[model samples]
Target chain A: AQTVTQSQPEMSVQEAETVTLSCTYDTSESDYYLFWYKQPPSRQMILVIRQEAYKQQNATENRFSVNFQKAAKSFSLKISDSQLGDAAMYFCAYPNQGGKLIFGQGTELSVKP
Target chain B: SQTIHQWPATLVQPVGSPLSLECTVEGTSNPNLYWYRQAAGRGLQLLFYSVGIGQISSEVPQNLSASRPQDRQFILSSKKLLLSDSGFYLCAWSVRGRRNYGYTFGSGTRLTVV
Candidate 1:
C-alpha cells in the first residue's frame, strides 16, 4: 500500500511572497506519479502540478513547481508570487499503475494581505 | 478533454436511510473510475475503483457499495446509511495512456448523516 504524508497541517504566506509545502510518501513500486492538488472554499479539487517518477527533473508550472526527489520519496510543492487567491487546502497525492490516487491529509494555506 | 461530475453538491440524510451518489464522465471512453471518501481533516480513503463495466474493486470493507453500469458512469450506494459514513465523497477518473497521469476529480459531494 502506498501512503502520502503531508507534515504541515496549516501554513501561512504573505502576499507576494513564496511558500513551500512538504510531502513524503511510502511506495514499493518503482514507477509511479506524484501530484499536488488545491481545493478552495468552493470544495473543488484542482490539479496543481505533476511529476513522473522516472523524470529526474522537477516539474514547474508558472508559479507552481515541485521538488521531486525520487530516492528519498519526497515531493514538495512551491508557490511563488503568492496571491490572496492562492489560499486553499493543498494535497499531495500519489498515483500508482493501478490508477487510484492516494492523497495526503492536506495542508490549509492562508495568505495574508 | 475529459471532465467528471458528481451530485448532489450537498446531501443530508437520516440514519439507516438508503444512500446513492452518482458520477459521470464526459468526452472520454473506457476510462478508469474511482470512488474516494475523506473524513474531516483526513486524507482520501479509496472505497472502490472500476477499470471497466462490471469490473469493480473494493479497497476497504464498509457498508457502501459501488457499481459501474456504464463505461463512464459510476454509482455509490448503501442500503442503510451510518453516521460514520458522513464525509466528503469524491469521484475521479484517469486514462490508460502509456504513462499514468494524475486523476481528475469531481466537485465532490458532502454527505451529512443525521
Candidate 2:
C-alpha cells in the first residue's frame, strides 16, 4: 500500500514571503513518481510540480519547488514569493501499481497581505 | 493539446434517482481515463479507471459505476443516488505508459443528493 501524508492541515504566509508545506509518503516500489496538485477556490485541480524518485535533483517550477528526500521518504513543497492568488489547497500524490493515485489529506494555504 | 471536459457543473438530485455524469477528452486517443471523488475539505478518492474502451477497473466498491463506451469517453453512472454520493466529482486522463507525467483533470462537477 502506498500512502501520502500532508501533516499540516492549514498554513498561513505573508505575501512575498516563503512557505514550506510538508509531505511524507510510504511506498514499497523502488521506482516511482510523485506530484503536487493545487485546488483553488474555483475548484479546479491544477498540476503544480512533479518529481521522479530516481532523480536526486529537486524539481522547480517558477515559484514552486520540492525538496525530495528519498531515503527519509519525505517530499516537501516550497513556495517562494507567495501571493494572494497562491491561496489554495495542496495535495501530494503517489501512484499505485495500476496507476491510480493515492493522495494526501491536503494542506490549505492562506496568503495574508 | 489535450483537454478534458466534464458536464453539468452543478447538479441537485433526489435520493433514489438514477444518475449519469459524462466526461470526454479531446485531442487525444487511447488515453487512460479516471473518475475521482472529493468530499469537502478532503483529498481525492479514486473511483474507477479505464485503460481502453470497455476496460474499466474499479478502485472502490460502491453503488457508483463507470463505463468507457468509446476511446476517449468515460461515463459515471449510478442506478440510485444516495446522499453519500453528494460531492465534487472529477475526471482525469493521462497518456498510456506516461503515468509519470501526472493527470490532466476536468473542471469537475458538483453533485448534491437530497
Candidate 3:
C-alpha cells in the first residue's frame, strides 16, 4: 500500500512571495509518478505539476516546482510568486500499482497581501 | 480534446434514499474511469475504477456500487443513502496505458445525505 502524507494542514504566503508545502510518501515501487493538484473555491481539481521517479532532476512548471528527494521519499511542492488566485487547497498524490491516485490530506494555502 | 462530464452538481437526499450519479467521457476511447469521494478537510478517497466496459473495481468496501455500461460512461449508485455518504463526489478519466498523463476530473457533485 502506498500512502502520501502532507504534514501541514494550512499554509500562508504573502502575495508575490514564495512558499513550500511539504509532502512525504511510502512506496516500494522503483518507478512511479507523483503529482500536485489544486482545488479552488469553484471546487475544480487542477493539476499543478508532476514528477517522475526516475528523473533525478526536480520538475518545474513556471511558478510551481517540486523538490523531489527519492532517497528520503520526500516530494514537496514550491510555489513561487504566490498570488491571490493561488489561494486554494493543494493536494499531494502518489500512484498505486493499479494506476489509481492516492492523495494525502490537503494543505490549504492562503495568500496574504 | 477529451472531456469528462458528471452531474448533477448538487444532491440532497434523506436517509435510506436511493442514489444515482453518472459520469461520461468524450473524445477518448476505452479510457480509465474513476469515482472518488472527498470529505470536508480530508483527501480524495477512490471508490471505484473501470478499465473498460462492464469491468469495475472497488477500492473500499462500502455500500456504494459502480457500473460501466459503456466504454465512456461510468455510474455510481446505492440502494440506500447514509449520512456518512454525504460528501463531494468526483469523477475522473485518464488514458489507459499513459497514467503519467495524469487524470482529467469533472466539476464534481456535492451530495448531502440527511
- The candidate that wins on DockQ is 2
User: Candidate 1, residues A9-71: lDDT per residue as tens digits?
Assistant: 999999999999999999998877888999888878899998888889999999999988898
Per-residue lDDT value at B80 in model 1: 99
Ranking by DockQ: 2, 3, 1
Q: Model 2 chain A, poorest ten-residue lDDT window?
A: A93-102
Off by over 4 Å in 2: none
- Which DockQ-derived CAPRI band holds candidate 3? medium
Residue-by-residue lDDT tens digits, candidate 2, B1-114: 889999989999999999999999999999989999999878899999999999999988998999999999999999999999999999999988876989999999999999
- Put down candidate 3 lDDT per residue, A1-113, tens digits, no spaces: 68999999999999999999999999999999999999999889999999999999999999999999999999999999999999999999986778798899999999999
Candidate 1 shows a clash count of: 0
User: TM-score ranking from best to worst?
Assistant: 2, 3, 1
At residue A37, candidate 2 shows an lDDT of 96
Runs of candidate 1 exceeding 4 Å displacement: B97-99
Question: Which portions of model 3 miss their true places by more than 4 Å?
Answer: none
CA-lDDT, candidates in order: 0.91, 0.94, 0.94
What TM-score goes with each of the models? 0.95, 0.98, 0.97
lDDT of 1 at A15: 100
Error of 1 at B99 (Å): 5.2
lDDT of 1 by residue, B1-114 (tens): 778989999999999999999999999999889999988866788999999999999999999999999999999999999999999999988886533566888999999999
